[model samples]
Target: MRYKNLIFDADHTLINYTADERDALKRIFEEIGLKFSDKMLDRCCYLSEFTWTETGLYDVKNERIQREYHNLYKTHLDLLFTRIFTEFPCSFSPIRAGELLLKYLKDGTNSISHAEETIKKLKTEKGYNIYIATNGLIDIQVGRLKRFAPYLDGLFISEELKEIKPNPLFFKKILERLNCTVKECLMIGDSLLSDIAGADGVGMDSCWFNPKSKENQSGTKPRYEIKDLTDLLQIL
Candidate 1:
C-alpha cells in the first residue's frame, strides 16, 4: 500500500534456475562427448551453493560456470577437448561453450517454474513498477526477462553495475538510478545475504522469498517472508 516500486530477483524467484542449470550442463557435456555425471553435478552444486559465503563471490555473474567454479571435471574436459581428433572429431571452443550456456539460459523450455501469470497480473492489474534485481550475469538475466517476463519494467543486475547486493552500494546504485526513495521500494529475493541485507541497509522494506526454507543463520529480519510467490499478491 505504501510502496511505489516493486523489485524482484530473477533466478529462483522468477525463473526456475536449477532445472536450467542441469540441462545446460548436460548440453555442455554432450558437446564434449561426455555424459552428465552425478559426481560432476555434485561439485558444481557445492560451488554454487558455497561460493557466496565460502568464497565471497556472491555478486560475480557468470556465463560459463566451469570457468569460475573450476573442478576436476572441467579440467578433465579441457584435456579431452585438446585431442579432438581422438575424442570424437569435434571441436571445443570456449566461445561456443559460452554461447551454448547463454542459449540454455534464454530457452524457456529450460527455465525453472515461474509465476509468470502472477507477475503479469501484479503489474497490469496492480500498477506496480516491476523491476528485476538479480545477482547473475546481465546478458543472461536480461535475455530471460525479455523472453519470459517482458511486462516488467526496470532491471538492476550486479554484472551491469559492477556491484552485488547485500553490499550497500548495490542497493544504492538502484536507488540512484530509479530516483526513488527507500520507503517507496520493496526488495523481494531468495538470498538473505544479498537481497535482504542489501535492502535493509538502505532502510528499505524487504520480502524474503524463502522457497527453499533456508535459514539466514545471520539473524537478519526481512519485512515479510512467504513460501510461495503467489503469496505476494496478499502483501502487494
Candidate 2:
C-alpha cells in the first residue's frame, strides 16, 4: 500500500452528517415552540452555510480580526432566530436557545454506509493507521464519533485545534501531530473544496467520496473518486 496513515474525514466520509443535522434542526425547532417545515430547514441551512463561508473568506488567522467560535456560534443562532421570526409564524425565548440547539445537534447520530466495516478492514487487513480529521464543533463531532473512536487511532476536530480545513495549516498541523509526511497519508472525504482542496494544498493524496454524484465545480481534483465507502477497499 502507498499510504500508511489514512486520514479520514468524519462528516459525510465515515458518518452521515446531513441526516443527523436535519433531524436535529427539526427537533430543535419543535422544542423551541416553533413549527418545523422542510422549507424552514432549507433556509436555516442556507443561512448557516452562507455565514460560515463569508467568515472563512477572511484572514481568520490574523490576531486583530480573530474572533472566538462561541461568539460566532451565538451570532449564528441569533441570525437564525431573527430569520425564523421574520418569515415564519414563530415565538420563542432567546435565553439559552443556542445551548439548547447545540445539545440537540451534539446528541444526534448517523453512520455512513460501510463505515465501520471499512475501518475495520483497513486497520486489520491493510495495517493502516486510521485517524479522523474533521472540521466542526468539538463537542458535536466528538459526540458523533464516540461509537467509532474505538476503531480509530486518533481524532482531530477543527474547533478544538483552531484550524479549519481548506487551509494548509490544518493539514500541516495534522501531519506534525502524527509525525507523518504528506506522501504517506491519504485524505478521504466528501467535500471538494475542503477535503480535496486541503489535501491537495499540502501535497497529500485525496479520495473524494461522492455518494451524491455532485459535480466538481470548484476544480479541485482528487486522486481517487469513489461513489461508495466500500469502494475504498478496491483502492487500498
Candidate 3:
C-alpha cells in the first residue's frame, strides 16, 4: 500500500454540512421569534468562521493557557450574539439566542456521499489504519462520528486536545499517536488551512477533497485532488 494511515476530516470532507448548518441556523432564529434570512445565515457563518479561526491560534501548553483558551472562546461567542442582535434588530437576549443555536449545531450532522462505504473499504478491505483529524467541539464531532466510531481506529479532536490543525503540532501529535511517519500517512480534507497546510507543515502527503471543484487560492497545495469521496478508492 502507498499509505498505511489515512487521516480524514469529518465535516465537509465526509459530510454534507451546508444544508444542516443552514437549517439549524434558521430553526434556531425562528424559535427565538426572529425572522431567519439568508443574510442572517451568512452573518452567522462569517462570525463562526472568524471565531473558530481566532480560537485555533491558541496552542495551550499549560493550565493557564488552557483557561485563557476557554475564555477566548466564550468571549468570541458573546460578541457573536451581540453583533447578531445589534445588526439584525432582534428583541431576544443574545445569551439565550446563542445557546439555542449552539444546541442545534452540536446535535445535528449529515454524512456525505460514499463516506461510510469508502471508510469501510479502506479500513476493512484495504487494511489501512483510519483516523479522523477534526477541529470542532468534542460533543459535536462525537455526535457526527458516533455511528462510524466502530469503523474508525481513532479520533483526534481539537476541543479535547486543545489543538487545531494548520498547526504542525496537531499533525505531529496524531502521527505519534498512530505510530506512523509522515510518509506512511495521507491527509484527506476540504480545508487548505487546517488539512493540507497542516499536513504540509509536518511533511505528510495530502489530498484535497474538493467536491465542488472550488478554486484553490490559499497557496498551499495538496499532493492529490479529488472531487468525490469514492475517488479515494482508486487513489489508494
Candidate 4:
C-alpha cells in the first residue's frame, strides 16, 4: 500500500453528526420559544454540514483567532435566526433558541456518529493505525472517540492544541507526535479546505470523501477520492 498512517476527520467522515445536530438545534429552538419546525430546522441543519467546508458556512470560533469557516458559520446561523424571527408564523424567543443550541451542541455526547461499520473495519480488518485530527472540542472529541471509535490511536483536536485545521502547524504537530514523516501519512476527510488542503500543504497525501458529488465546485484537489465510507475499504 502507498499509504501507511491514516488521519480521519471526526464529523461526517467518521461520525454521522449532521442529523443529530439538526435535531438538537431544533430542540433548542422549541425550548427557547423560537419555534423550529421540522422542515426548516432540518433544512438548515442539512445545509450547514453539506456546505460546511465548501460553502464557507460555519461559526467555528477559537480563542486564538477567528477563521473564515467560523465567520461564515455565524453568518449562516444569523441568517437562519433572522428568517425564523421575521418569517415564522409562530411567536418565539430567539435568545432562548440560541442558548439551547449552544447547550445542545456542548452537552450532547452520543451526537457524535460513526460511519456504519467502517470504523470497526479500519481497526480490525484493515489493521490501520488510525487517529482523528479535527477542529472539535477536546472533551467532546475524546469522549466520543472513546465511545464510538475506540480503534483510534489518538485524537488531535483544535481546542486542545490551540489551533484549527488547514494550518500546517496542526498537521505538523501530529507528525511530531507520531514520529512519522509526511510521506507515511494519509488524511481522509470530507472537507477540501481543512483536511485535504492542510495535508497537502504538508506534502502529505489526502483522500477526499465526496459524498455529495461536490468535486466540480470544491476547487481544492486531494491525493485520492471516494464517494462513501464503504468505498474507503477499497482505497486502503
The numbered model that scores best in TM-score is 2
**What is candidate 3's local distance difference test score?**
0.79
Better of 1 and 4 by TM-score: 1
Which regions of candidate 4 fall more than 4 Å away from where they truly are? 33-36, 43-96, 106-114, 143-146, 216-220
Error of 1 at 94 (Å): 7.2
lDDT of candidate 1 over 1-236, digit per residue (tens): 78989898787788777677667766777777765467766555444454333443443333233234323223333333343223334456744655565677666454334578778877888888888887666666777777545677788877677666666777899989999899999998888877788788889999998977887685789989988887888878
Output the worst ten-in-a-row residue range by lDDT, candidate 2: 57-66
What tens digits encode model 3's per-residue C-alpha lDDT throughout 1-236? 98988999988888766666666778877787778778779888787677656664334334454445545655666677787788788878777766666567666656888899999998999899889998766766677687677789899987777667766777888888877789999999998877898889889999999988999998988999999899998989
lDDT of 2 by residue, 7-115 (tens): 8998778887667767777887777677767887888777666755554433344443233543565566666656656676666644355566677777767889899
TM-score of each predicted structure versus truth:
0.76, 0.84, 0.81, 0.75
Q: How far is candidate 1 from the true structure (C-alpha RMSD, Å)?
A: 5.8
Of candidates 2 and 1, the better by lDDT? 2
Error of 3 at 179 (Å): 1.9
| Worst 10 contiguous positions by lDDT, candidate 1 | 64-73
lDDT of each: 0.69, 0.79, 0.79, 0.69
Estimate the lDDT of model 4. Answer: 0.69
